[model samples]
Target chain A: MINSISKVINDVGLHARPAAEFVKLASGFQASIKVRNLTSASAWVDAKSIISILMLGVSKDHEVELMADGLDEELAITTLRNLIESNFK
Target chain B: MHYTLVDLLKSEHIMMAVQAADAKAAIELLTAALVESGYAEPEFSVDVWKRELAFPTGLPTQPVAIAIPHADPDHVNNSAVCIGVLATPVEFGQMGTDGSIKLLVNIVFLLAIKEREKQVAMIQQLITLIQSPALLAGLISAKDKNQVLDLIQQTLNEEHK
Candidate 1:
């Protein structure tokens, strides 16, 4: 298991499009991924569920923790962290 | 910020047994109804259909298949929701699927949100009100326009309260 902390930089935070992109990427990996908004009251939610991420209602400049566990934990955490850092580009 | 789902819906905005051929058509039918009923502008339909093509809203809600199609705020005038019940299920791509996957959708929720900030919060609220099987069953079984409104209002109030 591995985890990384990152902040949401996009203007929309994790709203519709970005949230969908993040979930799509996270769903591709075999590792179990969960995300929690550190700056908000949201608990850890399944990163694969777009509904879960959207329901978090995370706004810009919010900090989040991404955790991954299973076969490709290291790769999942690194790649997801990069995705967030790049603002889902 | 303080509006109920019923506030955005009207009988003219509801369609039963809609026979749209595909996802785009489904969105077009609903958005057109909203536009005609003064809830949105004429361009809202085209923009919504385009967005639907790109990011399908077909949610895998149980008991009855549903989708929520929305457009950019620029194309909207007033916030509105148009509901449609399909006679036969239509194929709609699921939201957030990268490669491609279709969900057989029976109900459509076409949204025209004028305020940008309200959209996310509204979707979140809708997620809570919509994920219930009993509420969805009520919506699916509604026989009249009043029944639809009552069921939606009852479920939303029950869920949010």
Candidate 2:
């Protein structure tokens, strides 16, 4: 298992379009991915679920922890961390 | 300026027991209300519809399914939430899917956000409201727009904590 933490810098945070983008990318990986909003102290939720991501209510400057388990966990963590660091660009 | 969910919702924007053929019709029905109320421009409908086609917003919540359709800020004159309670459920492509997953949505929340900063918080408020099956049930069973508005206000009021 691999875990990493990152900050959401986008103005809209992880809702709407950004949530969709995050879930879509997370769904492509075979590893089981989970994310929790550290800033909000939200419970860990499936990274591929849109509703779960939306429920996190992660706003700008909020820190989130992403965890991946199974094969390709490293790649998944790297890709998703890059996506967040790039502000979902 | 920061706006709460109650501040963005109005009785005029709430349509109860609406009947629509499909997702587009449901969106158009709510979009028409927002456009007519001068909260959103005419092009707002087109932009929102296009975005819906690409990234559907239907969420399969318990007790009832709902959809939150929104567009870019460019066509919005004011930030408002237009709601429609469909008398009969309509099929909407599930969000975070490859257009294959579908959900029969009974209610639609058309969010017209003029400010980028408020979008995430506004949606979070809605998400908080919908997570409550009791509130969602009230929204589904409420007979009139006033009742819907009241329920939403009640839910949002609790959001302050």
DockQ, per model, reads 0.15, 0.16
**lDDT, candidate 1, residue B27?**
79
Residue pair clashes in candidate 2: none
Give lDDT tens digits, candidate 2, residues B1-161: 66667788898999988989999988888989988989988899998898788667888898999998887677999999888999999998886564578999998988887764445556678788878888889988997888888887887777676
Question: lDDT for each of the candidates?
Answer: 0.77, 0.83
Shift in Å, residue B63, candidate 2: 0.4
Ten-residue region with minimum lDDT total, candidate 1 chain A: A42-51
The residue-by-residue lDDT of candidate 1 on B68-157, one tens digit each, is 877666678788778898878898877655317888988888777775444545666677766888877887777877888888888877
- Residue B130 lDDT, candidate 1, scale 0-100: 67
| TM-score of the second chain in candidate 2 | 0.95
- List, residue by residue over A1-89, the lDDT tens digit for candidate 1: 98899999988899866876787788789987888889985566668655557866778899999989999989888988888889878
The CA lDDT at A87 in model 1 is 81
The segments of candidate 2 whose C-alpha lies over 4 angstroms from its true place after superposition are A1-89, B159-161
> Per-residue alpha-carbon lDDT of model 2 for A17-70, expressed as tens digits?
788788778878999898999998866767865556887788999999999998
What C-alpha lDDT, on a 0 to 100 scale, does residue B86 get in candidate 1? 85
